[model samples]
Target: MSSKFLFAALGLGFMLASCGNQKSEYDRFYEQDYKDSVSEAVANAPEPAPGTRTPSAPAQQQPAQEVHPGSKLIAGSDCTACHSNQQKLVGPAYVEVAAKYEENDKNREYLIGKILEGGAGVWGQVPMPPHPNLNKDDAGKMVDYILSLNN
Candidate 1:
C-alpha cells in the first residue's frame, strides 16, 4: 500500500513540475511593461523634420538600412544556410556565381528558373532545394541582388 502511494505522489509531482514552465498565450516576449514603455516614449517624443532623424529616439528609428529589397526574402528563407556573398558556404559564394554568369537578360532568366525549380550536380553534389512558392519576379530580384554583389 505504501509503495503504491509513493508512486502516485511522484507522478503527481512530475506533472505539476512540467506544467510550471509551460507558457500561455499571454506570455509574450513583449510584455505589458514593454508596451507601456514604448507608448510613453512615443507620446513624449518630438516629431522630427520629414527626412531627418530624432536624436533621442531609438536607433531603429534612424535612416533605413542600405540592404537590398531581396535581403528580407533571403533572411526569411533558407538561402543563408548555403550561400554567402564574399565567402564560400554550403554552396559557392554569390560573388563566384556573379563572376561565372553576367547579370544580363540571359543569365537572369536562367537563374530565375534554377531558383524556382532547384538544381543538382551543377555546383557540386549538394542539391539546391526547389522554392516552388517563390514567384519568378521575386526570384529575379534575388538574382539581381546576388549579381550586384560582384563589386
Candidate 2:
C-alpha cells in the first residue's frame, strides 16, 4: 500500500514539475506585459475638467417627485403584497428602501434587477420572490417609483 501511495505521489509531483509556470488565460492581469499595458493606458487617460461629469459616472440625481409611470406599474403588480411606501409589511418599507440606497441610474438598475429577480439581506432574513413575468422596462419604472420616495 505504501509503495503504491509513493508511486502515485511521485507521479503527481512529476506531472506538476513538467508543467511550466505560465499564467492561465483568466490570469492575464497577472502577466507583467498586461500590467505594463494597463498602467500605460491609465497614465494616458484624459482627465475631466472641474464640475464636469465623468463618462463612467451615473446621471444626476433627480429631485424627489412622483414617478407616475412607476406608480401605475406598482399598483398593477403584486409588489403591494408585501411592500408599501410608508411602512413595513413582510418586507422593508419603500421609504426605508429609498433611504438605504443612493438616488441614481446605477441604483435604479440594481433595484430593477432586484425587483424582477428578487433578493434577500438588504433588509433582513425575509427573501423577495422573483417576478419572472415582469419586463425590464416596467421593473425600471418600479425602481424609478421607489427612488422618487427618497424623501
Q: Which candidate is the best by TM-score?
A: 1
Each model's TM-score, in the order given? 0.56, 0.54
Q: How close is candidate 2 to the true structure, as a TM-score?
A: 0.54
Among all windows of ten consecutive residues in candidate 2, which has the lowest summed lDDT? 55-64
Error of 1 at 74 (Å): 1.1
Predicted candidate 1, C-alpha RMSD: 17.7
lDDT of each: 0.70, 0.72
In candidate 2, position 45 carries an lDDT of 52
**Model 2, position 30: C-alpha lDDT score:** 37
Predicted candidate 2 versus true structure: per-residue lDDT over 1-151, tens digit per residue = 2344444455455445545767576544335444454456555555654333354432333333633788778868988778777768788888998898988878888888898889898888899999999999989888878887887
Model 2 RMSD in Å is 19.8
**TM-score, cand. 1 vs. native:** 0.56
Model 2, position 33, has a per-residue lDDT of 45
The prediction achieving the highest lDDT against the true structure is: 2
Candidate 1: residue pairs that collide:
none
Off by over 4 Å in 1: 1-63
Q: Which 10 consecutive residues of model 1 have the lowest summed lDDT?
A: 53-62
